[model samples]
Target: MKFNFDQRIERRKTKSIKWSSEVLKNMFGEEDLLPLWVADMDFLSPPPVREAMMQEVEHGIFGYSIRSEGYYQSVAKWMEKRFDWKIQKDWIIFMPGVVSAVYYVLQGLLEPGDGVIIQEPVYYPFKSAILDTRCRVINNQLIEHDGRYEMDFEDLEEKAGDPRTKLLVLCSPHNPVGRVWSRDELNKVAQICTKNNVVILSDEIHHDLVYKPHRHHVLANLKEEYRENIITATAPSKTFNLAGMMSAHVICENSEMREKLRKVLDKNHIGMQTPLSMAAVEAAYREGEEWLEELLDYLQGNVHLIRETVKRDLPKAKFSPPQATYLAWIDFRDYGIDGKVLEEKMVKEGKIALDGGTWFGEGGDGFLRVNFACPRETVKEALERIAGVLNKEELK
Candidate 1:
C-alpha cells in the first residue's frame, strides 16, 4: 500500500468526540469502553490535505475568507472526472456542511405544512431537518431482502405524488444499510419526483468512497431533466476525513432554485470558509486521488475481514457486503437479543462501543452499524470483543 493506513495514531486525548469520556458515557451508557461507534475514520487525512492546510496556516492570515476561483474549478473538475458530470460555475453554492445546507433548503423551499419524503433506516438527520423546520415527514421505507436493502419504488411513487409532498431527501449509497443505488433505481426515483412535482436533494456526501465492482450513480447525471430538478450536496469532508473542516458544495442546475438556497444562506449570514479548510478541499480533490484509491482498497480488505470473522466466530450474524462507504450493517437478530440489550452487553461486557441499530429509525433494531475505517488490527479486536461478549465472556 502507498499509505500508512495501519498506523494506530492516538485520538483519545485530542478533544476527540469519539474518545471523550462524557461522550462514551452518554452514547454507550458506559465508561472505559473502546469506541468504534462514530462514523468518522480513525485514519489520518491524505498527505496532500494535511500539507495544504499546513501551508495555509503558515501564511498566518486566519481572518474570514471566501472560496476562490480555483476552489470551484477543483470541484468542477472532480465532478467531471469522477462522475462524468459537467457542472457550471453558477451551479455551485458553498455551505458549511450538508446538514446545514439541508436546513437552509427546507427553510427556503418548503412551507410549514409541506411534506418531505425520506427512506427509512436512513441517516437520522433527514427527519430532524424536516421536523425542525416545521415540515412533515413522509417515510417510504426501503425493502430489506436477503440481507440487503433496496428502495420501494411503489411506496415512494405513492407518497411523493401526494399534493402535500414537496421534497425528497435521498441518502445516496445509503449509510447504515450500504446499498449504492443502481442507475435503474435512480431513474425510477427521478421519474417519480418529476411526476409528483417534488424537488430532489441527493446527498452524495459519500460519493467518492464507493467500493470496486459497483459504481455510484449520480441521480442528476442520469438525465438532463433530472439534473434540472435535483440539488446535489457533495463534499470532500467524508471522502478525505475532513468533516471537522466543514466545507461542502451544493450543486443546483436550476438558477431559481440555486438563488432560493443562496438567499437562505445569505439571511443566516454564513459567508466564511476557513483558509485551511478551503485549501484542504482543493488539495484533496486535486492531489489526493492516489491516497483515496489506496484507502478504498484497505477498506475493502476490512470488509472481507469482518465477513470471515463473523461467519467463523458468530455464525448467526448476517451482513450484506457494502457497495460503498466504510460502515458495516450487521444483523444480530439470530442471536435473539434486543438492540438495546446487545448494545449494553457489547459496551459493558466486551468494552467495545458500536452504533446500535435503533438510532437509524424503525426496522433498525437487531442490527448494528460498525465503522470499519480503521486499522485492520483495530477491526479484528472490535470483532473479537463483540464475539466474546456474545459468548458470555467479560472484558478482562
Candidate 2:
C-alpha cells in the first residue's frame, strides 16, 4: 500500500507531547506556536504496527505480559537483516527507553564520581544521565569545519585514557548535528575505549534512519574484540515512530557486562512491557520495512525542502543536510544573535518551537535543532517563520 507523506494528520487534540499546549506553553512560553520541536515524528506509525496494536486493544484483555521467543527473534532478525550485525537473542535486554537504559547502565557499572565521556553538541539526556548518576562529564566536543562535524579522536583518546572515565556514551548517527559515523570513526572509538577499559554505551536509536551514500555502522558490529566493551541501545521507537510504546533494547555481547546490567535492571524493576507495545514492536520489525522505505524517501524530500528554504529565505543561516535522522541543526551565528536571545526570538517572534542549540551543551550556541519529520508543507512553513525572525531588521 502506498502511503501519503504529504497528509497532515491532526495532532493537537491527541495527547501528543510534541503538540501539547501545556508543553509548548511551559517550554516556549507560548501555547500557539507552530511546533517543530521534540524528537518524535508527526507521521502515523506503520500500518502493520497500528493494526497489531489495535488487535491487542480489541482483544480487551490487558494483563501482565511475557515477551515470547518470537519477540526476541524479531529483534534479532532485525539487527541481522538491517545492519548485518548477527546478534544473538541472549544479547538483547529490554528497557522502557534508551535514556532509562543509560541510567541503569551507569548505576549498574560505575561508582559515583567516576567520569563519563560524551560528545557535544549532543542529545542532552546523556549529560543529564551522567550528572544524575553522580558522575563527572568529560566533554569530547565534535569539531565542525565548513559545516561538517567530525570527531576529535585525539581528544577522545585523551579523555578515554583517564582512569576516572569508566564509560563513554556515544550517540551513533548523532542527534541534533546528524553525522553518521563512518566505519573508520567507529573503529577508532572502539579502539580508544577498549584500550582504556572504558565501557562504551552506543545509543543507536537513530541507526535505521540514515540516508543513502552514508551508512550507520553498529559499533559492536565493527569487531569481535570490541564486542565485550560495547553496549548498544536500540529501539523501534525512532525507526517505526513507536516512542509511545516504551520499548527499547540494549544489546550487550559480553556475559559479564550483560549480567551487570541485568542486576541494575532487576534492582530497579525495569523489565516490563505492555501487551499492545509487544504486538506493535513485533509487527513493526516483522512487517514494517516497506513503510520505512517509503518514509525515508519522504524524509529525504523534506530535507531537500529545508535546504532550499533555508538557502533562499534565511540567507545568513548555515544548514548542512543531515546524513542521518530527521533533525536539522542549523547555525545562526552569522546573525549576531546570542543563543538565549535567538531562542527567545524563535518563540516570541518566529512563533515556532525548536530545540535550541544551547540545550545540547557546549558548541551548541547560535544554533537550532529543527525536527523535519513532518509534511513538506509544514517544513516550509517552519522555515519561513524562522526566516522572518532572523531576517528582522533589528536583529541584523
Candidate 3:
C-alpha cells in the first residue's frame, strides 16, 4: 500500500534486453511487440537498493571491490529471518550470477565426460550450462499430473546411481512450472543424490518470491548431511528486479567442495563484484524485505488476473497456480495447437511476446511461460491478447 507498484514506467528507449526494440524484432519478428518473455520485472528496484546504489555513485572512486563482513552478515541475516536457515560467513562465496555459478560448479565438480541430471521442462540455462561444459545432461523428465508437476523419483534415483552422473541441479520453486518443492519432495531428492554420491547444486534464485500460503524449503536446511553435500546459488537480483547488477552468492557448507569450486573461479580469474552491484546486494538483503513483501502481494494479484482472464476468455487454456515466483506456466494443449504455431500466433495475431513452451524441452510442448511481475494492467493486456488469439480460432 505504501509503495506504488501500479505506476507504469516506460522502458522503450532503455537498453533493457526485455524492452529493446531490436531484441523484440529478433525474438518475436515484430518491433512493436509487448515483451513478457523475460523473467525480470518492469518495476523499479526497491528504494533501499536504489538509495544504496546512489550513495555508492556519489563517491567518485569506481574501483574493484571485495565483499566485506557486512555483506556476509546481510545474507546471513536474510537466510535466518526468511528461510530459518542459518548460514555462516565462511559458507558464502560471491559470483556474478546464478547461471555463471552453475557452470563454474559443473566445471569444478564434474569431468568433461561426466553426466549431470536436471528435471525438465525446466530452466533452459540448466541444460545449456551442462552442455557447454562438455558434460552430458541426463534429463529425468518431470511428471505432469493434472496441472501440477512432480519429479519422477525412480528415474532420478536410477540416473543418480549411474557412475557417470556426478551432479544434480535442483531448481527450487522451479521456474516455468512454478511448483515450490516441499520439504518431503526435497528430502527424497537429497536422499537419492546422497545415496549415489551426486552433489546437489540447488538454484534458489526465486526463493524469496514464493506465494504466502506455500513455504519454500531450502534444500540444504533439510539436514546436516544434505547440507554438506549441497551448494546453493541465490541472489537479490531476482528478488529486487536488479538482474543487470550481476551479483550472486554461492552457499557451500562442505569445506572441501567449497575449496574446489573456489579454485575453479581462481583458475578462470573470476571473482570481481562491481561496486554498485555489491552495494545493491547488501542493501537488498538487509533493507529490502518490506519492499519484497509488497511486491509479492502485487504479483499474487497479477497471477489471479491471468488465471481468471484465461478461464473467462479462452475457457480451454489452463494454468497451474504458482506456489513461488511471478512466472506462470500455462498449458495450451486444450486448444490443440502446436507450441511453435501458438507462439507465432501470439506475436503476429496477439502482439504479445511470450516464451514458447517447447523451448523448455519435451513436456513443455503446447505450453507458454508468462511473466506476471508487471503491473495488473500489463498482465491484463497480455492475457487479453492471448485469449483473443485462441478464442478467435475457436469461433471458426
Query: How close to the true structure is residue 144 of candidate 1, measured as C-alpha lDDT?
Result: 93
Q: Judged by lDDT against the true structure, how good is candidate 3?
A: 0.91
lDDT of candidate 2 over 136-251, digit per residue (tens): 99999999997899999999999999888899999998998899999999999999999999999999999999999899899999998998999999999999998988999999
lDDT of each: 0.89, 0.93, 0.91
Can you tell me which runs of candidate 2 are displaced by over 4 Å?
394-396
What would the TM-scores of all predictions be?
0.97, 0.98, 0.98
Show model 1 residue runs off by greater than 4 Å: 393-396
**lDDT per residue as tens, model 1, 1-396:** 879999999988877788888889887778688778877899999998899989988898898787889988999999999999999998988889999889999998999989999898988889999999999999899899988788999899899989999999999989878889999999999999998899999999989989988899899899987788999998888899988888998998989998888888888887588898999999998898999999999999999999999999988889788999899999998888888888778888889888888888877898988899999999999999989987663223
- lDDT rank order: 2, 3, 1
Write down the worst ten-residue block by lDDT for model 3.
Answer: 305-314
Error of model 1, residue 196, in angstroms: 0.4
Compute the lDDT of residue 120 as modeled in candidate 1. Answer: 82
